[model samples]
Target: MLWLSCVDETAPALPAAWLIATDAQPANLPERSALRRSLACKVLARQFGLPDAAVEIGHEPAGRPLILAPQGSGLHLSLATRSGLVAIALAPRPVGVDVEQVAPASEPPLAMLHPEERRWLASLPASARPETFAQLWSAKEAYVKALGIGFARAPESFAVRLDGAGRFVVDGARNGGPASGFVRLTKNGGHESMAAAFIVLDQA
Candidate 1:
C-alpha cells in the first residue's frame, strides 16, 4: 500500500517525531519543510507500533530518506512542501512526494520542460500553460526523488512524454519499470480564486 498526507504548517509533530530529528534547527520555511517531512515519517512509524527510538529517519548518500530500524522495518517514505502545506508519501518500496503551490505560477513553465516537452506545451493554448506545467514539474520531481538521486539528475534528461493513446509516460525506466506517478490538487485556502496546491506522488 502507498500512503500520502498533507498537513498544515502550524501543527506540531507528534512527540515521537522528534527522536530522529533532534539535530535539526530549522530557521526558515524551506528548512522547516525538510524537518516536518522527517518528523512525519516518525509519526507514521509510531502509528505502526514502533517505539520512538526504534524508528529513525536517515538519508542515503543522495539525501533520500530511508527507514533505519530493525532489518524488517516495513516502511518507506518520501515528502515535499509548498507554500503552507507539507506532503508525505509512504510505501514498502522507494517512494517520493512533492507539493507545489499552483496559484501564482511562481516560475516560467517553459524553462522546466524538456526540449520535446517544450514543443508540446507550446502547442497548448497559452491559458493552459500553468496547470499543465505544474503537473509536469511535479511529476518530474517525484521521479527523480524516487530514484534516490537528487538534482544531480537533470529534469530535462528524461521526458514525461505521451503515447498515441495520449497517456503520460516517462521517457525511460528505473528499478525495472517506470516510476509510477500521481497528482492531487487542493484549494489554496478557503477560496477557489488563486493558485492551489498539488501533491505529486511517485513510487517504484
Candidate 2:
C-alpha cells in the first residue's frame, strides 16, 4: 500500500511493505534529518510492533537508509525529497521512491535521457512534454535508486518509456524489463504540482 500525508497529519497504519509521501519540508538540513528519523521510527515501530525508541536509522556507505536496531527485519527503504515534498518507500525487498516538482520547460534537456526516450518525448506535442518529462525523470531516478547505485550508472544507459497501453517500462539496462511500479502526478493544494514514482525491484 501507499500513503500520502502532510507533515502535520498522522500516518495511517501501513502494510508490511508500503510507500509514503509527505508534504513535510523542514527549513534546514538538521531539521530534515530529524524529520526523516522520526518518520522512519514511527513507520518501523508500527510495522515491526516494536517501541518507537528501538528504531534506529543508519546509512550505507553509498548513503541509502537502513534499519539499524532491529537489524534482521528484512525491510528495505528508499527516499527522495524535492520542492518541499518528501517520499519514503518501505518494502520486503528493494524499493525506490522519488518525487519531483512539475515545472514547465520549453526545451527539456533530452540529452540526459536514452535515445529512445528522447524520441518518445519528441513525438509528443510540445505542450505535453514538460509533464511527461517529469514523469519519466522521476521513474528513472526511482529505478536507479532501487538498484542502489544512484547515478554511478549513466542516465543515458537505460530508458523509461510508455508502452502502447500507456504503462511505463524500463529498457536498455542489464536488468531492463517491464518496470514493476508506477509513476503518478499529484497536485499539492492550488499552485504546486508534483510527479512521484515508486519502484520495487526483485533483486537487490
Candidate 3:
C-alpha cells in the first residue's frame, strides 16, 4: 500500500495514519534535513511495531535511504526532495519517491539533459510542457531511488516516458504487462511528487 502526507513543520508529533505514520515538516533545508530523515524512520518503525532504538536508519554510501531491520524482514524505501516538502515511499519490495517544486522554467533544466533527453523532451507538445518534463524528472528519480544507486546513476541513463494511457516507458522498454507496478504523482506544496513501487503479488 502507498500513502501521501503533508505536515506543517511547526506542528510536532501528529498522529500516525493507517499504513504509516508520517511526521512531515515543511521546513527549510539544513534545519529540517535531519528531522525529515528521523521522522521517516520513526513513522516506518512505528508501522512495524519496532522500537526507535532497535531500528537503525542510516544513509547509504551514496546517500540513499538505509534501513537496518531487527526482524530480518525485507523492505526498501526511497526519499527525495526539491524545495520545501520531503516525500517518502515504502514497500515490501523496492520503492522510490521524489518531490519537485513545479515552476515556470524561465529556463527549464532541460539544458542539463543529454542529446537523447533533449530530443525526447522537445518532442512533446507545448501544451504538455512543464507537466510532461516534471513527470519525466520525478519518474527517473523514483527509478534511481528504486535501484538504490541514487544520483550515482545518471538520470538520463534511464528514460521514463509517459503515454496517453498513463503507462510508463523506461529505457525504450514499456510496461504493458502486469510485471512492474505503476507510478503515482500528485501536487503537494505546489510541487510535483511521485512514488513508484514494484509489488510481487501471489495469485491463487
Candidate 4:
C-alpha cells in the first residue's frame, strides 16, 4: 500500500493540499516551499475517502514527522517536497520522506554536514557542489526523518558517499547504528528531488 505523488509547482489547477498553505497570511508566508507538509497527507486522506478535518498530524520535538492520532488501520504515509513538486508515499508500515530543492543549499544545510562531508563537498568542482550536496543531504534527511530523530543525530554521524552518476552509498556505522539506505534522483519541477523508502517488514 505504498503511494507516492508529485505535484506540479506551477500547476494551474490547485489541489486540495494547497489550502493548508492558503489559510495563513497572504504576504508573510513563503508561497512555494514553505507550506506545511501535512497538506499532502490531507490530500491523501481525501483520496482515501477520509475526512481531512479528522486527521491529526503533529511533529516530534526534534522536528521529525509524527502521527498524533492513530492512523486508520490500513495505511501509513510519508511525504517529500522540493521546489514545487510534492511526493507522498503510503504503505502498511511506518514511513518517512524528504524533499530538498537542488540548488545552492542555504548556509544552514551546509553547516549541518560534518567536516568529512565538508571535505567531500570541497572535493567536488564548484559547479557540482549543489547537486552532489543536495542528493546526499536529501537521502540522509529522508532517513533520519524516517527514524523520527531529525537533528537529534548529527548529519555527519552517518557516512554518505556518491561515486558514479546516480549511484549513492550510505553508511551509518559512524552514527553508532547500522542504518542506511539508497536513493535515485528524479527531475521534478526542473529541480532535482531524491526519494527513498524502506520495504516495510510484515509482522503478520
Candidate 5:
C-alpha cells in the first residue's frame, strides 16, 4: 500500500500512541526532521494495526532510517519533509519520497542534473526553471532513495523524464517505469510551486 501524509509542523495535537513513539525517539537529536520521522512511523504503524512499541527504528550506515520491527514482513516506507510539510510513502517493496518547495532565488548546482536534464531545463523559460528544478531534483532523490541506496546510489547513473507538469517517468529503468507526484502552486506567504514525488523501485 502507498500512503502520503501532510503533517502540520506546528506541534499540533497527536494521538497518545504517537506521542509516546515520538518521545521514545532519541532526544536532543539536533534535527527536528528526526522527530517528524518518528511520528511518521507511528502514524504508519497505526494504519497497519501495529502497536507503536512493536516498531523498532534503526539506521543504515548511509544514515537512512530503517524500520526494524516485525522482521521479514516485506514492508517498506520512506519519508520526506520540507517547510512544515511531511510526506510519507509506504509500500510492500522499497519506496522513496521527496518534498521540494520552490524558491525564486534558488541557485542549484548543475552537477546534480544529467546532460539531458540540463538541456531540458535550458529549453524552458527562466520563470519555469525554478519549480521545474525542484520537481526534477525531487524525482531523482525519490528514485535513489527507493533503491535504498540513498545518495550513495548515483541519481545521474540513470535517467528520468519529466512528463509534463507534475509527472515523472524513470527513463532508463526497465520499460520506463513511472513515479507518482503531487504538485501545486502555493501562496502561503509568497508565490511558490512545491512538489512531492513518490517512487517505487524495480525488483532486485
Candidate 6:
C-alpha cells in the first residue's frame, strides 16, 4: 500500500507490501539525501524486521537506490523531491514515486509530453490544465523511475492518461513491460497541495 505524511510527522509505520511516503521538502541538497536514506532505512527495518543500522542504501550506476548490506532482500525503491515536498517508495518489487507542488503554469511545457498526452491536455478546459499537467508529469516520472532508466528514456516517448475510470494509465514502447500505477492530488496545508504518483512494474 501507499502512504503519505509530512516530514515533521512521526516516522511512518510500514505495511506488509509496497509503501510510499511524502514529507515536507528538506531545505538543502545534503538534507534531502540524508532524509531519503533515513526513510528508506526505516521502511526496510520495519518491513524485514531488522535493525535500522543493518539496512544500507547504495546507488546503481543509473542512480537507482540499491540495498547494499541485505544481499538478497529482493527490494526496490525510488525517491522524488519538489518545491515543498519529498517522496519515497519501497516495494518487494521495483517501484517508483514522484511528488510535486500543484501550481499553475502560465506556459505549460507541451513539447516535453507525448503527442497523445499533449492532445489530451489540450482537450481539457484552460482552468484544468495545470493540475492535469502535474498529474501527467508525475505519472511519467514515476513510470520511468520504476524502469530504473530515469530520463535515459525520453519523457515524450510515452503517454500517460486518465482512463474512463479516472485511473492513470501508461502506454507506448518502453524497455520495461506491464506496469501499473496511480496519480492523485494530496492536500498539504490550508492552501498548498501536491501531486504524487506511485508505480510498480511486473517482475521479469
lDDT of 4 by residue, 1-204 (tens): 222343222222211112111223223334532454556546655655566666665555665445554464455545555554555544454445555555644443556786777887887787778767776776676566556566577886766766554445556533344444445555554434433333221221
Rank candidates by lDDT, best first. Answer: 2, 6, 5, 1, 3, 4
- By lDDT, the best candidate is 2
Per-candidate RMSD vs. true structure? 7.2, 3.5, 6.7, 7.1, 6.7, 3.7
**Per-residue lDDT over 111-202 for candidate 2, one digit per residue giving the tens place of the 0 to 100 score:** 99999889989999988888888888888998888888898989999888754333466776446455656777776433367777877776
Clashing pairs in 3: none
Q: Write one digit per residue (lDDT tens) for candidate 5, span 1-204.
A: 223233222222211111111212233444546755666766656665676777776767766556787676566667665654455665666677776777668665557788888888888888888888887887888777777677775666666677776557776663245544433333211223556677666563
lDDT of 6 by residue, 1-204 (tens): 646463323334421122234445568977877866786677667656778899899999998888886788676768776653557676777777887667775657999999998998899898888888888888888888888889888999888876534357788735455456777777643336678888777653
User: What's the number of clashes in each of the models?
Assistant: 1, 0, 0, 4, 0, 0
Per-residue CA lDDT of model 1 for 161-199, tens digit only, reads 543332345676465555445554544333222221122
Q: Is candidate 5 or candidate 6 better by lDDT?
A: 6
TM-score list, all predictions = 0.68, 0.81, 0.67, 0.60, 0.73, 0.81
- Tens-place lDDT per residue, model 3, 92-125, is 6556666544454434578655457678768867
lDDT of 3 at 176: 34
Off by over 4 Å in 4: 1-3, 6-38, 46-56, 60-62, 67-70, 74-76, 104-111, 163-167, 173-177, 186-204
Where in model 1 is the C-alpha error above 4 Å?
A: 1-30, 50-54, 69-71, 103-107, 162-168, 188-204
* Minimal lDDT window, size 10, model 6: 10-19
